[model samples]
Target: MDSISSRIEKVNPSLTLAVTNQAKAMAARGEEVYGLAGGEPELDTPDHIKAAAIVALQEGRTKYTASGGIPELREGLAAKLAADNDLEYEPKQICVTAGAKMACFNAILAVVEEGDEVIIPSPYWVSYPEMVRLAGGTPVIVDTLESDGWKMTPEQFEAAMTPATKMVILNSPSNPTGAVYSEEELRAIGEVALYEDIVILSDEIYEKLVYGETKHVSIASLSQELYDLTITVNGFSKAYSMTGWRLGYTAAPPAIAEAIIKIQSHSVSNATTFAQFGGVAALEGDQTFITDMREEYDGRRQFMLARLQAIHNVRVVEPKGAFYFFVRTGDIGLKSQNLCDKLLSRYKVAAIPGVAFGYDDGIRLSYCTTLDILNEGLTRFEQFCREH
Candidate 1:
């Protein structure tokens, strides 16, 4: 009898994790490796948030409250949506999940059906397409251009739609590219969605990591039509340095939110109880820590950009937000995977290939690590470019 499910037969391992793990293995063997593949903040979780979690643990808030989340966290998330994003979602319209990734997955699974088409822009986070596949949906990959700063134009989005189209994924301060979409651009895309009557999944997990003059806009906030059709996903991982806490939330229409909760209850139940308390604290507590982290990240982004710009033929679009630089590698006569492999094995620097993110001719390097590691990795990157 055949054993394994075909559900996962074609799924690829996470390229970012694969590269990071290989670098770790090499380092374990005493190789001097600079791992720049993963997008995790180097900062520790803020002490105040940790104290909130500790207080929760001490009070024995260890059991599951609701599949959506504890009422306090949900209320905090609701207030956050209203205050920060200018989108009003009642507590009932929100569902907390293990992480923003899981929230995204839940949204996809809740709405997408077999043979339904999900329009994913090129250079997307690797998980978007995979999550669509897991939901038995067809991923309609639309290519965005470097000349356009890697954003999907309204025309491109409209061109990709069909009667079968169910949803589209948009990430601002996009992973791997750090391309922050302007409000004008998002409104244009939202207009397309409103005209086509397609659902939009707006992933704004990196909403707070933007650089100078780059504002993060929630498409749902632009109009009620977009809000009705949008499911906004966010988490504490990027902004709060709480990646290990596995706390995230989705704000959708009431029906969609309930559907997500139904699916979540049957599967993962709720996010960790104490972690949800921390999430509440993250939202309701003092936010000065976020400004500090953003400032530090801006500094690193500037350093990384300058260094990469110095490398000949390695053109990079200035990333306005997030912590990644997608360096165009077409000038080097090698496929992205091959280029990445060579960089890791020969130079001991780990970066993810752009092919993993549905783009070729580039590779994504994360600047979320320390300045010393970034300097070392970039130095190796320049040497490798010169040799090639």
Candidate 2:
């Protein structure tokens, strides 16, 4: 056999995706799998957004757009950013990409060179370390304590920074744990960024999915310097139920925006042109659809957190925002992957292991499924805990 590319060979596959495939294969065999492996919203995209896409296609908006994005999208997105996040950005400063994932990739690719370091908090998103490795940068993981709601502190932020540290990734209403940083917490981190001249890659993809009285705060909104150093990455996937549309954008500094556009042109060129039109409507049209979905998800988030608490050994912190319950199942004493495997093969419930998120001892339960399915799955989970 021929040798593979060294860069590809050096990186591990996405751990979340591995569990997703395992669940999918099980479902293919006619298993009644109540899967919660993927973080995607299960709700359908609202009809209004789809209607806009159809209208765009009919208007011959199917052709290639400017490499960054169409002017209309950039304008709409610029307005959405200012109105929603309280940060002002011009159309040229915004670059619409394939998804938040790709936008982050482009940002990292643009800024980091070989031997650069990216600081990520532990129980971090599985993609962070892998992406850094693929970009020829090292990921320095800072462990946030469970007592602190799995959030990094300002001291830790300062300690993690070195001359080689080029970027720091922040995920609010975070994945895996669903923890949200308070405004104060963000300001503290922002201060560190101000001191170090380090870049902040704020992944606010789950921004709008926050629950209860909590709200999403863009670090850029905290101060002017934060606004300059921060690259606000977001998309319609979770909020607008537009995961299938593959639309996301980055609100970055002018220089970074130009670099990202260069990378975009050489790779994806432009995201689906029709989807960009849908995005314009998503930003401009009835936001009530997003609000309604958040309400439904909030109910499920509360319900799922309560149910998990009932299991004797599992300790779960109620997520402030986002629809995930990352549980600390101390009594089972099994690796999260092994437990996830057992839970799926026996109970037909597919929760992902926390090892993927750098928490080897826990498991992540995505509560994005129907409430009835969640109840049924929780029952099976309780029974599993009892037996094991």
Candidate 3:
């Protein structure tokens, strides 16, 4: 007997994890694999943040606190939002979860339901459509153009809306493409969502990783109307290099925040107790770690962009933020999966296929690793491109 629920059956396992795990297994067996498929920063979490968690543990703060989050962390997040993103969210309007991923899932479960249509731009983070499907919502994928820097225009969002449309998932400094939407672009999209009464899920996990002159703008901060319509999700995984800590939060309007807290109470109970203290330190402690990480990622981004452009038959837009580069490999004449397979199996380099991100003509290469690994990976990748 097959007894899996329909929602579970509809979900696809994360292709990013599949590739990264395969690469890890091969490396464990002494294989030389240049792994570029990961999403987390290679940098270490700051000593201060870790010390805070250790202090919490010493003080026996491991007991479960509020279902949404501890009061201290929630208050810290409120202050951070107001000072950094210019979004004024009270502590009660926040729901901290295991990760930004869970925060997104909880928001979807709270607001989306059967027959609801969620407009998600293509080349999205792989989990968006899956989460919508799990929530019994129809995911309307709007294929975005590379010429538009893989961002969905307001016109496209308007064209995709229906009476059944309930939400739109917007990722700035997107995971696969690293497309950071401008304030004007965000305002235009927010206007459409406001007019249509569609909810907005703004994923800003990569907010602190932006580079060059590209500024990260929170759509929810554009206006009070957008703020009311948006649920903002962020976490410590990227910026703080705290992926294993499992701490993230959602800031939403009162009703939605209450709903998210209710769902979380019945599910995960809350983010880990001591870890939330680390989250407090992350918000309030010295922020120089972020600046240092951003500078290093920028240097790597420039180097990778130059090397990729020099390679034959490969095209990549310089990513404005985030560490991944979505590279067009259609000129190589094989689809993304087959191309990535050959790279991993033969060339000893692992990269995620673009098919995972809803774009099959390309692949995603993460530049968060060391320059030596990147140099070797690009060398092998360039060879594969030449031979293919």
Q: Write the per-residue lDDT of candidate 3 for residues 1-388, one digit (tens) a residue.
A: 8888978999999999999999999999999999888799988899999999999999999898999999999999999999889999989999999999999999999999899999999999999999999999999999999899999999999999999999999999898999999999998899899998899999999999999889999999988889899999999999999999999999999999999999999999999999999999998899999999999999999999999999879898889999999999999999999999999999999999999999999999999999999999999999999998
Candidate 2 lDDT (Cα, 0 to 1)? 0.89
Give the least accurate 10-residue stretch of model 2, judged by summed lDDT. Answer: 1-10
Per-model TM against the reference: 0.98, 0.97, 0.99
The alpha-carbon lDDT assigned to residue 64 of candidate 2 equals 88
Q: Candidate 3: worst 10 consecutive residues by lDDT?
A: 35-44
lDDT of 1 by residue, 1-388 (tens): 8797687885777987888788889989998899788788989999989999999999999998799999999998999998899999999899999999999999999999999999999999999999998899999999999999999999999999999999999999899899999999999999999997899999999999999988999999999889999999999999999999999999999899999999999998999999999999899888999999999989999999999999996889999999999999999988899999999988889999999999889999999998999999999999999998
| Candidate closest to the true structure, highest TM-score | 3
lDDT of 2 by residue, 1-388 (tens): 7589777877888878888898889889888888766688888888899999999999998988988898999999898888888989999999999988998898889888899999999888888888898899999999888899999999999998999999999999798889999999999999998898889999999998887788899998888878889898998898898888888999898998899899999999999999999998888888898888888888888888788878888888888988888888767889998999899999998888888898888999888888888889889988989898
Local distance difference test, candidate 1: 0.93
| 240: Cα error in model 1, Å | 0.5
